[model samples]
Every structure is written in C-alpha cells, then in structure tokens.
Target: MRLYSVIIPVYNRPDEVDELLESLTRQTYNHFEVLVVEDGSSKRCDGIVEKYTNKLRLTYFYKPNSGQGFSRNFGFEKAKGDFLVVFDSDCIIPDHYFETVEKYLDKHQLDAYGGPDRAHDSFTPTQKAISYSMTSVFTTGGIRGGKKRVGAFHPRSFNMGISKEVYQKTKGYKITRMGEDIEFSIRIIELGFKTGLIEDAYVYHKRRTSLSQFYKQLHFFGRARINISRFYPDEIKLVHMLPVVFTLGFFLMWVLPVVSPVLFFIAFTVFISFFGLIFFDAFAKEKSLQVAALSVGAAFTQLFAYGVGFLTEGWRKLVKG
Candidate 1:
C-alpha cells in the first residue's frame, strides 16, 4: 500500500484540532499517518495529542511561533509518506476523501489534486454567507474555466497534495507571510506536472462566525499579499487588483462628484454590479432570504476590510521601499 502522510499545521485552537482528529478517526482509508506540527502558541495542546497517542504513527512537533508556511515546511521535512497532504486545522473531510483522492490520482496519473470546499452545513446564516462570499467570484478574485483539471494562477495550500519527489526537486515551502501556496503551485506547473481537482473530494470548512474573527483573517491575508509581492511580482492581478482599484476609484470619485456626475455614477454602478454578481451567484445555489442577506453583508464586509488592509499594506511596502 502506498502510504499518504497528512501534515496539518495547527496553532492556538485546540477545540478545532480535536474536531480534526475526530474526523480523521472516521476516515475510510487506513493507509495514512497524521503529523500535527504545533506552531508556537501560548496555549498548551499536549493533552490533545495524548488522546490519540495509541496510534504509533502519529507524531507531534513543537516549534517557536512560525507562520503557517514554515510550519508546513517543517511537517514536509518529517513526512515519510509517498504523498504529502496538507489541510488547514479547521477542515472536516468526508469519510471517502482520501480514497477518492487516491483513486483520482491513479486514474488520471496526475501530479497534484484538490477539490471543492463546502462551508459547514451547521454554520449560522452569517457564517454560510461569509463562506459563500469567499467562494464567490467577486471575493475569490475570479477563477475561470469549469474543467476539473483547471489550474489556478494562485492555488491554495490548504487542500493540496504533492509527491515526495516534487518537494525534493523544488525544495520546500518559502517563509512567506501569505501566498506561499501560490508560489509552490507555480513551481509545480513550471516543472510540467499536472494538477487536478477531484470534484467529489469534498471538505467542509468552518467559516468565521463573528466580525472580529473575519477582520483578523483578512488582516493576515492583507499582510500575506504584501510579503508575497516581494517574490511574485504579478501576484496582484486583475482579480485581486480590481477591489483595490474600485476602492480608490470610489474615493477619487467622491472628491470629484461636482466635476463629473458620470464618474460618480460609474463608481457606484461598478460597486453595485460587483455585489449584484455575488448575490446572484449565491442565490442561484439556494434561494433563501438568510443566505441572500449573509452573502451581501459578507461581500461588502470583505471588500471594505480587504481594501483597507491592502492599502495599509501597500503604504507600508512603499514606505519600506
């Protein structure tokens, strides 16, 4: 049996980590070992591991608070499986997730694979809305093409797997604040390896249920983009660039409204159009009023928060430069 090493980098949230372990315990596939690398956190999580210490294959490592990129790299170095799978601490996988991934990999002879991330069904309407907003074309920066074998310009490391040779050849993760996954995937594509999305390999992610948590997440992403720009110059493309542009456009148009009503109209039109698309796409899935409200609020919140974060980071980068 080809062994798969599932490497998860966890920090601070012991409760979610417990849920992750519980999900793993129920997985149908047994040819896997889990390695949980604890990035530096103030809370002690040794007891969490103790619950599953009976598994001889389970290993835990503690390192000073490094970013997720470094924690994942540390896990990759210690992984002994033929394939390395990485998941965020909050992800809850289906029972057949691994079996489906293995089947898809062998069936297509692909180098890497990922799938759709579904928001937890049990989430509140606001949480579901935020989750949908993140997945929406507006907030996700627009991922085109419906083909299962679609390659993202910037794919996430959250639900990704790679061969041992791929890491050995390219070296491991970069110590970036964010977008390390994109950099890593770009390298894989450059190596001429195929990446696929198994539509059936589904996962449920816990969306941030509160505004405070949501802002913190966006803040990290904002800081991450700043650091990644140092390496991948084109990291800020149309999908990501539009929101910032619109934000600035809104501000500029506000000052010049008396000069050109057309410019002011255009700015508001774009803003409405952007949110319209998000709401339309979300409602198409489920025509519930709650979902609609959540979707709209989430989209607005993300755009506003992300725009502020981006400009803040941009200013800091410019000052440093």
Candidate 2:
C-alpha cells in the first residue's frame, strides 16, 4: 500500500477544520498522513490539530500569509507519502475515500487524478440545493460533476492527487489564487503528466450555506475560465459560454413576453418546464418544499453569478489589452 499525504491549507475556520480532521481519522484506508498548513491566519488552528494527534498521523505547519498554492507547496516539501492529495478545509471524506482512490489509481496508472464533490446527507437544504445546481447534468450539463464530466479531465485541487515524482518534476502548485488549480492542471498536461478521474472517490463539500456566499464563490469560478483561457486559448469551448448565454437569455426571457405575448408564452412555458424538472427532482429526493423552492433560486444564482463574473473578467482583460 502506497502512502498518501493529505495536505489541507486552512485559514480562519477552526470548527470546519476540526470536523474535517475527525472525518479523516475515520477513513478506512490507513496508509495516509494529514498535513494542515496554516496560511498566516489570525485565528490559529493548531489547538484543533493537537486533539487529533492521538488518532491520526497528522502534521501542522504555520507560514506567513501566502495563497493556497504556496501553502500546498510548503506541505509537499515536507510530505513523506508517495502520493500527495490536496483538499479544502471544509470537506468531509467517506471512510472509503482513499480505498476508492487507490483502487482506481492502481487500475489506471495516471500521474495525477481528481474526484468529485457532493453535499452530504447531513448538509443543510441550502447546501444541497447549491450542490444540485452545481453538479446536475440536466442543469449545467455536468460541467462540475465527475460522473458525466464534459471536455478535459481538469483535476480540481479540492479533491486532487499527484504522485511524488510528478510533484518534483512540476514543482507543485505555482499560481496563487482564483484559478490556480486549473492553471496547474493545464500545466500538468502540458508537461506530459498523465491525469485521470476517480469518479467514486467523492467528498462532501460544504461550500457555502447561503445563496449570497454561493454567488460570490461561483463568481470567482466564472472568472477563472477567462484566466485559464490566457494559457490555452483554444481550450475554451462552447460549454464555457453557457453561463454567459444563460445570463443573456435570462433577461430576454422576461422582456420577450412583454414585446410579443405569443413568443413570450412559448419561451416562458419551455423555460418553466425545464426549470420545474430540476425543482421537482430536488423536492422528490429531499422531501422538503424549501429545498424545491430554493433549488430554483440557487440554479438562477449559479447561472447569473457565473455569467456576470465571466463577462466581467473577460471585459477586464479586453480593456487591459
């Protein structure tokens, strides 16, 4: 069994880190170590790491405030495992997460790999709704989900892994914020590093509890698309344009009805039916009217937020050029 180093860069979230640590201690795969790198956070999480000392093979390091990319590289420098795994502080992995990853990696000898994320059963209705909007194939055509991934297998850092040899060759994460993970993945591929997807090794990503927070998070995500485009101009695909198109269509959907009732009626009915399908699916699974209702708003917010962010960043680059 190859050893794994689970590196997590944390800042200002003691409680969430504690929960994540506990989940790690419960993993069924025992050949892994956890490293928590403090990114110059005012609220130190060292005390929380101490509590898990008895149960987990954990290491804690503190460095001056740098971006996640730098912090992850810091951890990798000290990592003793053959595989380096990166995760956000707010994620919960199942007991079989490493087992699932090892099994997949053994079958497919990729230099790096990434898993998917979903809302846990214990997650709040808001989180679940947000997850639905983020991952639903029928909603966004599986841009974020691993099961039916579209386009290239761009390994996300939140649930990503790399062999020790690859890390040494590529020098680990170089970019700092926003789209660092994506930029790193692109570089990995460019360097001839093999990458694959571990669809079953999913994690519970408690990304944001409120719609406002979710909007801000995705807004940056949308901007990342433009960031990545600078590196790989032709990699940007039609699917990347969906959010912008949706944003434009969203406004037109409201205006078309007023201008021409016949066209408006036809468009509105089609839009509502498609929207209703997602809502009903959430309602049926969650058995909560609140989840159903919030799903609609969440879906809209996801599209609109990403759309605006993409356009905003693209416009910024255009102006700078």
Candidate 3:
C-alpha cells in the first residue's frame, strides 16, 4: 500500500478545519497521513487538531503567514509519503476517496492527478446553487472537474496529488497566490510529468457560504486566469474569453437601447434565453425549483464578476507592459 500524505493549509477557519478533519477520520483506506499547516491564523485549529490526535495520523504545524500555495509547500517539505495530496480546508473527504484513488493508480500510470468537487448533501441551498453554476456545462462547460475540458486536464491544487518525485523536481508552487495552482500545473506538464483527472476521487468542496462570498471568490478566480496567462501566454483560449464576452455583451444590452432598440432587443433576448437555459439545466440536475431559481443568479454573478475581474486585471497587465 502506497502511503499518501494529505496536506491541508488553513487560515482563520477552525470550524471548517474541524469539519474537514472529522470527515477524514471516516476514510475507508487507512494508508494516509494528514498534515494541517496553519498559515499565521489568529483563530488557530490547534485545539481542533487535538481532537483528532487519536482518530487520524495527524500533524499540525504553525508558520508565518504565507498564502495557501506556500503553506502547502511547507507541508510538502515535511511529507513522508510516496504521494503528497493537497486539499483545501473547506472540503470534506468522502469515505471511499482513497480506496478509489489507490484502485485507479494500480491501473493507470499518472504521476499527478486532480479530482472534481461536488456540493455535499448537508450544504446550504445557496452553496449547492453556486456549485451547480461552477460545474455546469452552461457556465464553465464542466471543466473544473468535468470530463469535457478545453485542453489538457490541468490538475488543480484543491484536489490534486503528485508523486514525491514530481515535488522533488518541481519544488511545488512558484508564486504564493493568484492562480498559483494553474501555474504549478502548467509547469508540471511542461516538465513532462503525466497528469490526469481522477473522476471517481471527487471531494465535497463547500465553497463560500453566501452568494456575495461566491462572487468575490469567482472574481478572484477570473483574475487568476489572467495571472496564469502571464506565466504561459499560449494558455489563453476561447473558453477563457467567454466570460469577458458575456460581461461586455451584458453592458452592451443596455447601451444598445440608446443606439438602436432593435439591437437592444436582440441582445436582451439572447441574454434571457441563455439564463433560461442555465435555469433549466440546473433544475434538471438538482430537481429543486428553489435551487434552480437561485442558480440563475449564481450563474450571472459568476460570469459578470469573473468578466469584470478579467478585464480589470487585463487592463493592469497591459498598462504595466
């Protein structure tokens, strides 16, 4: 049995860490060690980690505030496993997660892998709606963990794992934040490391609790996409630009009325039809009217916020250039 070191970087989120730790205790496979790295958080999880001392092979480390990427690197430095796995603090590991990964690895020869995220049954309706928009084909084309990706599947850090050799060669993340995962994944591929998606090894990712928080998170994600493009200019694809087009078209809809009512009517119709599609798709997947309704708002918030962030950061990049 290959040992897996699970590294979780936490900030001021003790409650979330507690929940995540509790979930890890139920994993069916027992060949994993958990490392909780505290990144200069005031509300520490030391007390919470104490609770799991007997339940899991767990270690807690406190370090000065470096962003999540570097905090993960700190964990990577101390990992004593054949493979190092990274998970966000705001995630719940399913009981069968490791068993599925071990089974898959026995057949495939991937040096690194990433898995999709789903909203847990216990998540709030808003959280589920946000998850739908994030993973929906109508929005992100299900690329985050979906089978239909734009290009090569770049394993994200949230549910990513790599062999100890990969870390020894690449030395983990380069930048501390702003799309660090994307940058690291690109480097991993560039270094000729094999990467793939482990579809069955998904995690229950409880993203932001509220729509406003979700918007902020997506907005930062949009900026991060542009940030990744800085490291790998060729990575910018049509799929990434779709949000910008949506945002620009949204503003054009209102401005078009001043120029020509026909143009505005056309844009308005297209926007409404697109959002209607999102609503129906969400309904089909969730089977809840309330969730479907909230999904529309979530989708809009996602696209608009991401678009604005993309444009905002792109302009800054251009100015600096």
Candidate 4:
C-alpha cells in the first residue's frame, strides 16, 4: 500500500478543520498521513489537531500568513508519501476516498489527478442550491467535474493529487492564490505530465453558507480566470465568456423597455425561459421546490457575479497592460 500524504491549508477555520479531521478518521483506507498547515490563523486548530493525534497520523504546523497555494507547498515539502493530495479546509473526505484513488491508480498511470465535489446530505438548503448551480450543466459548472470537459482535465486543489515525481520536477504552485490551482494544473500539463480525473474519489465540499458569500466567492473566481489568462492567453476559452454575455444581457434587458416594447418582451421571455430551465433542472435533481427556487437565485448569483468580476478584471488587465 502506498502512503498518501493529505495536505490541508487552513486559516481561522478551526471548527471546519475539526469536522474535516473527524471525517478523515473514518476512512476505509488507513495508510494515509494528515498534515494540517495553519496559515497564520489567530484562531488556530492546534487544539483540534491534539484531539486527533491519537486517532490519526497527524502533524500540525503553524506558519506566517501566506495564501493557500504556497501553504500547500509547505506541506508538500514535508510529506512522506508516494502521492501528495491537497484538500481545502472546508471539505469532508468520504470514507472510500483513498481506497477509490488507490484502486484507480493501480490500473492507470496518471502523474496528477482530481475528483469532483458534491454537497453532503447534511448541508443547508442554500449550500445545496449553491452546489447545484456550480455543478449544473446549465452553468459553466458542468465543465468543472463533468466527464466531458472543454479541454484537458486540470486538477483543482480542493481535491487534487500528484505523484512525488511531478512535484519534485515542477515544485508545486507558483502563485499563492487567485486561480493558483488552475495555473499549477496548466503548468503540470504543459510540462508533459499525465493528468486526469478520478471520478469516484469525490469529496463533500461545503461551499459558502449563504448566497451573498457565494456571490463574493464566485466573483473572485471570475477574476481568477482572467488572472490565469494573463499567464496563458489561450486558456480563456469560449465557454468562459458565457457569464460575461449573460451579465451584459441582464443590463440590456432593462434598456430594451425604453427602446421598444416588443424587443423588451422578447428579451424578457428569453431570460425567463433560461431561468425556468434552471428551476426545473434543479427541482428534478434536488426533488424539493424550495431548493429549486433557491437554485434559480444561486445560479443567477453565480453567473452575474462571475460576469461582473470577469469584466472588471479584464478591463484592469487591459489598462495595466
């Protein structure tokens, strides 16, 4: 059995760390070691790590505040495993996660890999709605973990793993944050490292608890996409522009009423139909009207916020360039 080093980078989220560690304690494959890297958090999880010392092969390190990408690099430097895995502090690993990864690696040869994230049954309705909007085919979320992606599968840090050789050659993430994972994944692929998706090794990712928080997160993500394009201009695909189009159309809808009533009605109907599609799709998957209704808002929040961020950041890049 290969040792898998699980690296978690956290900042002022002890409660979330406690929950994530508790879930790790139940893993069916027990050959992994856990390293919790505290990125300058005043509300540290050292106490929480103490609780797990007896239960897991756990180590806790306290370091000055750097963003998550570099913090994960710190853990990777100290890992004792054939494969180094990165997980966000806000995630709960499924019991079968390691087992599934090991099984997949036995048959296939991948230098790096990533898995999808799902909302746990215990997550709040808003969280579930957010998850739907993120994973739904209606949004760009489909390309994230969906089997058929726009291009090569770029492993996300939230649930990503790489062989020791890959890390030794590439030296982990270059930037600390702002689409650091995407940037790292792109470099890994460009370096001729074999990267792929592990479908069954999924994690329960509890994203932001509220729609407002989710909006901010997505807005930041939109900006991050532009940041990635800075390093590799061709990384910006047509699919990424959908949100910007949606945002522009949203503003144009209000303007249409003054221009012509018929045009306004046509635009309004098109927008309503799109949202209606999201509502029914969410309802079919969630099987709850409340979640479905909230999903519409979540979907709108995801696209609109992302679109605004993309435009703002794109403008900044243009001016600065």
| Candidate 1, superposed: residue stretches over 4 Å from native | 54-57, 144-154, 260-266
Q: How much is 310 displaced in model 1, in angstroms?
A: 2.7
Model 2, poorest ten-residue lDDT window? 138-147
Error of 4 at 7 (Å): 0.3
Mind giving the per-residue lDDT tens digits that candidate 4 earns over 1-321?
889999999999999999999999999999999999999999999999999999999999999999999999999999999999999999999999999999999999999999999989999999999999988888974688888787899999999999999999999999999999999999999999999999999999998999999999999999999999989999998889999999999999999989999999999999999999999999999999999999999999999999999999999999998
Error of 4 at 256 (Å): 0.4
Using lDDT as the measure, which candidate wins?
4
In the range 1-321, model 3's lDDT, one tens digit per residue, is 999999999999999999999999999998999999999999999999999999999999999998999999999999999999999999999999999999999999999999999989999899999989988888896678898887778998889999999999999999999999999999999999999999999999988888999889989989998898888899888888899999999987888988999988888999999989989989999999999999999999999999999999999999997
Give TM-scores for every candidate, taking all chains together and pairing residue i with residue i.
0.88, 0.95, 0.99, 0.99
Pairs clashing within candidate 4: none
Clashes per candidate (backbone, < 3 Å): 0, 0, 0, 0
- Residue-level lDDT of model 2, residues 1-321, one tens digit each, is 889999999988889899999999888888999999999999999999999999999999999989999899999999999999999999998989999888887788999988888889899989989987877776577766446767668898889999999899999877788789988988888899888888898999998999999999889988988888887787678887888988888789889866999988888887788789988988886788988889988988988898999999999989995
Q: State candidate 1's TM-score.
A: 0.88
How high a TM-score does candidate 3 get?
Answer: 0.99
Order of quality (lDDT)? 4, 3, 2, 1
Q: What is the lDDT for 286 in model 1?
A: 54
After best superposition, candidate 2 residue 93: deviation in angstroms? 1.1
- Residue 231's lDDT in candidate 3: 82
True-structure lDDT of candidate 1:
0.75
What digit string (tens of lDDT, one per residue) describes model 1 on residues 13-57? Answer: 788778777788877887998998899977756689779767436
